[model samples]
Target: MRKTFLHIKIIFCSLVVFSSLAQSASFDCSKASSDVEKKICNTPSLSKLDEQLSEVFKPLKKQRTFQVLESEWLENVRNTCESVECLEDAYNEQIGFLSPLPLPGASASNEVKILPADKIYAQSSRPWKTVELAGLPNGKDVVERFLISAEVISGILHVVAFEGHYDVPNSIYRGSLYEYIDRHPIVQPITYTIAKDIGFQGAFNLGNNEEGERYAGIMGGTFYYREKIARNQLRGMAYKVGSGTQPQETSLLLQQWSNTFENAKSGLLFQGDEVFGELKAYYPNTPGYETIAPVDRPEVGWNIFSPIWSKSRPVLYFKNGDETIWRANVVDKTLTKIVSASDQLVIKNPTPVDLNGREAVVYLEDYILKIAVAPE
Candidate 1:
């Protein structure tokens, strides 16, 4: 009887140990075949970190850019971990990258207020207004779509529109490039014949060169292809327009081939060989280029994209994350958060405009174009 009781107690203890290991990790410990997977199952602290990382990665899995980053991390960082300590460190780093950081110096007094789409034009004390463009010349009704880019040059508004349905599969973003003079339309189709299946992926920029000649530029390809190209790769072209001259095409080399707005001294800003490399500037009229921001020291957040130039100053605005707009003064090396949405909103294409002598910003919110006037 004593022997039988000892046998029963040993079996019960073994079962408890098995159950703990099975339920600890985010993945099933029973099917854990890899060395790293086995280490995570056996270690309690590492298993907890794995669970935390899984939760943080859930919402961002659908993003293609994030997906690529995650895959690289798994192959380069997580899978190469040889010990439990290395695995723990890798998991922590990934979780931090996926999570949102606290907004720097966020306060109510300095935050820019955004009006509702329906009540944009309504009388209010808030400095918000919706962009009202006249009907297209082709008699087509102007629908509320995604504003890819917008700029005000010489008191004229140039805008590029997309289909606004980013979630849909294989939805081609073919729309007209319009020029609005004082809210009236002189719309023309800037036809994108190259890669018609994929459409444009980046912002449509309109700026002037050193000789005061105006030009228009945009990236033509899929997002993935553009993102993976090297610095020396030929990305797109810029067409020299206006000034009573014929449209002359100039090949734009490297990535981010758009011209930076600096009045009569506009130039090209692009990255180096590295994906997150040093920011370099090249003037069309100058002999050589200069470095604006080095790789070791980034002036602004690396994730900021869709640059909209300020006509009055040597400043450029970018959209950070999904809801914050950051203004970067390249000359002064200062980055300021100009706008922060109160809720979960995708604020896109922050364009600067002079509204009757009032400095204001125009951007897309839920497929509608809205403007926010700068505080005096």
Candidate 2:
């Protein structure tokens, strides 16, 4: 998540040694006179305050002092959960059980902390989809609700797609098992043809066109998707949200036939019990688009929420597709999720970034939107 200047100040205080009384017992809410004061004294509120204070004083609390880099653990969690949820339903029937899987290194007491050096949040497992050049029995070649990585060929993007396979008797699904390679149109001569003079050496943009119908310039090109949208493009490729920015992204193309391209533009999410709706473009200035006033949707109220924001990107940009809720970045050259949403639309492009454990997923349906990962 984006580290506010206030957070930096808090970090500074965390590094120093304070008085014993300063670190003593908390206030008693039962004896508080005011509701606000009493609320602050309550268990959850008190705990939050303590955590906030501790975070601010982290630098001082630790014996070894080091640099504090911003991370987006919340964004990571939200995007990961959303993306996995997209396919969770379908995969649930295919798999044998129905329970949330624990993240790597997750324990009862210890929570995953976001570090600056962490390029991605999670890793890919076995038993994924297959990528191939020729058509399979289904003949569609492209499979929905999955993750894959491809390299740039002689000016083309080549990715190996695979369906996750379960080992019989063992009852374990080999995670992210390689399937086959699928190739789509790419710019001939690749990056060299576009900018021969510039020294740009990076992976080929094997992204889907997400924001092609609306939100002009918001999403485009694999490079733009990777840099601007980041992991949200995975959902875009999956066709969870919308395709306002680019259509080449995976998800957007999937939704093209449905013609409900602006699914991610504005929507609501029910997490546990709370409901959140996007408000970034609630009142749009552009013509041809109807403005959704808060009064019209009192449930959303005036405080329309956006996805979590990180140093790199926003979470809302990655829209939810039919089977993929939020296709996000597990790390470089890899993606992860549990499929479920057969009708959910996803915008291609618009990805997420990790900022101090705050996770954000961006999805551009008619407009760029996001969803934040709730605290553990």
TM-scores, one per candidate: 0.37, 0.22
Query: Model 1, which residues run further than 4 Å from truth?
Result: 105-376
User: On residues 151-236, what C-alpha lDDT tens digit does candidate 2 reach at each position?
Assistant: 22232222222222333343322222121211222112111211111111111212222212221112232322111232222223
Residues 1-376, candidate 1: write the lDDT tens digits: 9999999999999999888788899888988999999999999999999899888777656433245456778888999999998998899878876664432232221122222223211111232323333332332433324444455444344444443223224332333333223321223333221222223334332211111222223223211112112333324433222222222224443243342443313343644221454434444444555544344443443443555566555556655555766655544445556676546766765767654344567666644445554443
The TM-score of candidate 1 is 0.37
Best by lDDT: 1
Model 2 weakest 10-residue run by lDDT? 62-71
Alpha-carbon RMSD, candidate 1: 20.3
Q: lDDT score, residue 195, model 2?
A: 14
CA displacement after TM-score superposition, residue 66 of candidate 1 (Å): 2.7
Error of model 1, residue 155, in angstroms? 34
**Whole-model alpha-carbon lDDT for candidate 1:** 0.49
Which candidate tops TM-score? 1
